[model samples]
Target chain A: MEDKVKIIEIKKSVFAANEKTADDLREELKQKGVFLLNVMSSPGSGKTTTLVELINALKDKIKIAVMEADIDSDVDALTVAKKTGVQSIQLHTGGMCHLDAEMTSQGLNGLSNLDDLDLVILENVGNLVCPAEFDTGAVTSLTILSVPEGDDKPLKYPLMYQVCSLVVINKIDVLPYFTFDVAKCKENIKMRNPNAEVIEISALKKEGIDKLADWVLKQVKNWKENK
Target chain B: MHELGIVFHIIKQVEEVANKNSVKEVTKVVLEIGEVSGVVPKYLHDCWKWAVENRSEHMKNCALEVISLKATSYCKDCERMYDTVKSGRICPYCQSKNTYLVTGNEVSIKHIEVKDEN
Candidate 1:
């Protein structure tokens, strides 16, 4: 006797529904006049340090808030709040390595100062592979690529480089110490995403912070003017 | 890795589809994962084996099948397509710098098999 089975074709992405939810969340954030930016990087890529500088640069100009995502720790959120004195919240991913659009929306709802904030920065968990796959409903997506991570990262992890609107080459101050070539990195990034804007900065030394801040200001202004 | 989370997401989708069609027991789940989608098939299988047992009563002992899609890139100047992992954004035919990915960046559920009601 043969066991009976029925084949059902369901050619659907597990992420399709998440993408729709992300688009809706983007529209909602637009209506509420909030520019959300998702920042991703590998562990110890100086994301929190870079974010501290960014918050300082834009704090006087606009109302800012931060959501720090980690697999288990809330230390980054505490650091951001202590250093910036702004509305900051910690999002424990509960073993989820990346934050999806629904998780981002839930995080936004958890923030009590959404009405008073102009920008919401999601400091995504430090991991290159997973965070890039999920859209967190942000207006812009940025990735921090430090010098120590090597220049061939764009070629190895092309998806992360491709999805990012901006790629910040952090730790430029340590460029002399490492064998990282800025031009090579830029070329590789261009191959993945021709339109991605690349900026070199050292969050520790505060070099190129102005350029990054200017770009963020422009993005925020564009979001405000267009939406 | 985040493969466990991905497994949960897939199970959720499968459960939703099963409920919509009134499927009592899911016997198999076919997933189409691209070569460059960042999901390790072995890890995914491991997670599926664990999560399926714990997810739903109908999904117990379900078999997960994965089909790998090749990553291909298209060269603009050479107008040729090559395996992305082997070529690395350079057109092997013409050695052109202007190249872009064409496929192999997908992660989706393609098919589901259910046991017939006796």
Candidate 2:
């Protein structure tokens, strides 16, 4: 007797399951009137400093919280808590490179007073690659690129730029020291993503923080008011 | 690495399908991986081997077969398709950056091979 083998068709993307979960999570957040923003950047790209500045600028107008996702360590969450004085939590990915929809939902649940919060900023793991691939159920995605990291980053990491709605060019205060070109950087970003808005900032020096804050406020308002 | 995460998702999906079909064992899984999907096939295989043995019940010792797809992009200016890996976002013929990827970014499961009781 010969062994029998049957083939079953299961044509689906590997991300299909997660994508569905992300969509459902987005819908739920929408119903609850909460806006989620997933922030991605390379290591030491001034994400923590930038967040502190932006959160301080908007903390008065709206209720906000920050979830810092890292493979290990809780320093980011603590910094955001101490500096901006908003609700903050640390999510340990257990050596994973990125946060998926489920982890994000779990983090959201762990926050105190979730209903009262208007916006949640998810500071994703400091990697340019994996973070962009996984949808963290955020209403919008932002990527931070510092001037020292070079202007051709958009060309190198095309997918990251393509997925991000906003790209913050940070550390502009040190631009004179590096061979970074602002116009060329903007052109590269536009090539990859035409609609993605680029804002130049020096998070350390607090340059362009107001424009970034206004952008966040508008996004939150639109997320709440729009059908 | 993300390959591990992706492998976990694949295992979960395969488990659901096996449970739904009442499959006792899955011997093989076929995947369609695009050239520019950013997933390395070598890492995916390594992750799959570990995950199937440790994490999955019905897919123990399952073999993973990957079908590599060529990445192609459509140039809006010239209205032509070219190899994405070679030309990237900019079209080779017209040198226009106004282009979009048409294919080769997929990470899809095409089918599964299951063994039946005699």
Candidate 3:
């Protein structure tokens, strides 16, 4: 007599619920011609500071909204809201290192007037690993790497580099103090994402902000054209 | 870190399978992980160490097996598949730009082994 154990078969994605919600949210955003930019980066990598510059540059011309994901405080959400004067919501993920499309969809739900907006930015939790897996149905996923974090970032974390549409190198003004090689970094980025744009800037000093803004506007324009 | 979350998902699936089959216990689990999936086998084991222990009283002694899937590239020109190390986007046969991925990008529980009582 053999030991009796149960054997059953099931094939399903762990992200099934989140993926479905994200798809519907994406469809809703598409109908309104609103583009959601899923932004990801390591903690204190200047993702928020970059957002500040971006909002400061485009707020008057574009109806931009922000969904800031953080584990504890609403500081980032407040910072971006103060700069853009647009609708900003802070999503407390508690301790999750990533943001799935379900949280993002719920965050976007707070803004009922999304139909009138041109852009929606969902600031993902500060982690390179988990966030790359969640699609969120964002048209484009953007990542930030500050100069202090070393230029070897892309090679160390390839998936984030591979899937990202843009790699924004923030805090270039401090490049003189750091040993970061811009060329090698660009090469690494291009290796993984040859088609993705590389935007170099110092988000804090406001230097190169215009170029970054231009790139965002260009992508948004391209999205509108295709839509 | 996300591995535990994945294990939780797997546990739920395991429970469903057990309920449907009207079985007593789960003895083994088989998983195929892709290199591109960015999942470290060691980390997965560490996470599963805790998840499986907590999920089931019977599964406390069950085994988790991981099979690595090698990433391969596809050449559109030659309509052939090759390993990722030797090729990325270029077709080694024709050196053409038409290339795509053929395999090695997946994470699935392929099979589970168990004993059945009469």
- Top DockQ: which candidate number? 2
- Candidate 1 lDDT over A62-128, as tens digits, reads 9999999998978899999999899899998888889999989999999997977899999999998
Best by lDDT: 2
Error of 2 at A208 (Å): 0.9
Candidate 3, residue B116: lDDT: 81
Between the candidate structures 1 and 3, which one is better when assessed by DockQ?
1
Residue-pair clashes per prediction, in order, are 0, 0, 0
In order, what lDDT does every prediction score?
A: 0.90, 0.93, 0.80
What's the DockQ of model 3?
A: 0.40
Which lDDT tens digits does candidate 1 get at residues B1-118? 6888788888888888889889898999999998878888999987787799987667998999999999999999978889988876678899887888788877899999998776
Better of 1 and 3 by lDDT: 1
Worst 10 residues of 3 chain B by lDDT: B83-92
Off by over 4 Å in 2: B75-78, B90-98
Write one digit per residue (lDDT tens) for candidate 2, span A1-227. Answer: 77699999999998998899999999988888889999999999999999999999999999999999999999999999999999999999998999999999999999988888899999999999899899999999999999889999999888899899999999999998999999999989987787899998999999999999999999999878894
Best-to-worst TM-score order:
2, 1, 3
Q: Candidate 3, residues B3-99: lDDT per residue as tens digits?
A: 7666765776666676667766778988878877777778888978687788665466668988888988877678888776465545678866566
Give fnat, all candidates.
0.75, 0.84, 0.35
